[model samples]
Target: MSTTRPQLPDDRPEQGGSGVDDGAGPAAAVGRRTRRLTLVGASGVVPMARDFAREALREWGWTPAEGADRKAAAEDVLLVVSELVTNACLHAEGPEEVLVSTDGKTLRIEVSDLGSGEPAPRTPHRAGRPGGHGMFIVQRLSIDWGVLRVPGVPGKRVWAEVAAPA
Candidate 1:
């Protein structure tokens, strides 16, 4: 739920489709795919969330069977998912939901929580630090990531994107 980059993605939908599946706009698959899981009040949320994301990746053809590179890519996505969910659990009371979406070229992972505190990477990162590496890891693994306030809502959504393997 934290990031050093904090680079905001374009505020527009992808292509001619909404490319979002949380009911934020008109529904349109159009070759895009999404999977969502509610973690609110759930026990053992971190591993549960990671498993959920792994299934989505495999279902979307990102797996060892795809090739070695694809397998590594899938692992990276799983790590990002774990870090974000864990951050929410630690900093935001707990995560409310996890939404994973792919548009053929990139995978987006979102973690939503009710906490109002903003997530920012610990600046001047120290290599020997013992903790607080979550956001730093996220920033390194992701192509772009940032926090978005949910309009008319009390919570915010932290999102990260990973490029598909070539």
Candidate 2:
């Protein structure tokens, strides 16, 4: 399955933590609180959603330290985001949403779609197929990932987390 990319909002402000700016001027002090970035109707918004999540994490206080530390973690997070979002768009019908947040120690990524079907890893024979590797990749890269059925929502939310690089 394939999908076209969604139009992202161009007016998003320079990222900040907790949706708030500290008194230390925009450049003075980095915010320490966890921040939430949400993308609604993510049917075709996979790429943009990944970018949004990365930017939100950077804005929330994560910075690349010396010697390939934060960059690797950032890449992993982006990859997982892409996999999860793409899976939602391809397997689910109707609108989709993505929620990203970080608790300093770990980053949380979640994608929700209108389709109630839960995702499962493909078998070894199916692994050679062109599609269906998204969920598998997510499972491999994330420390932990799973699906949750929300009471009021029409679909399940697939979520994953990776430890924040020190």
Candidate 3:
């Protein structure tokens, strides 16, 4: 008699650029947990990144509370995501991956790209300028942010963290 092979279930999660739910819930934990998104060839990558972030936050129960600011705290997160992704697309020739994570009251975002150049805000500020405000937006919105570059590596990761709504 012949033996049959056992069936295995697929545990991989769905990837989407839209805010629509694909049945993947937010990650659960008391400490830091990371979710990575591969960005190569992703259409409408900026909004997609924002949607991905919003979904993760919803899973963590980070929605805006009653009597809070009219601009939902999630909007700030979306702005940060847009700015970081814009910078990656502009300066770094687009991002290779995007990492979203939360640690208690702080949400962290990291955009990894292939460019070797460091990122910096325009000197002396330029609010009146027609463009060049991406990093500046990042500087103002984030509670804290910086770049991480491994020695001898040809790429860099720009990260920012914002406080969650109460």
Candidate of highest lDDT:
1
Predicted candidate 1 versus true structure: per-residue lDDT over 50-136, tens digit per residue: 988888887788875577888778999999999999999999999988888888799989888998887777889997989898989
Model 3, span 13-82: residue lDDT tens: 3243422332334443334555667788778889888888877777666754455552466777788889
Q: What is the TM-score of each candidate against the true structure?
A: 0.83, 0.70, 0.77
Each model's lDDT comes to: 0.79, 0.63, 0.70
Q: Where is the poorest 10-residue window by lDDT in model 2?
A: 2-11
lDDT minimum window of 10 residues, candidate 3: 1-10
Off by over 4 Å in 1: 1-28
TM-score of 1: 0.83
Better of 1 and 3 by lDDT: 1
**Which order, best to worst by TM-score?**
1, 3, 2
- What's the true lDDT of residue 53 in model 1? 87
Off by over 4 Å in 2: 1-44, 63-65, 125-128
Local lDDT at 90 for model 1:
93
RMSD per candidate (Å) reads 4.9, 9.4, 12.0
Best by TM-score: 1
Which clashing pairs does model 2 show?
A: none
Error of 3 at 5 (Å): 50
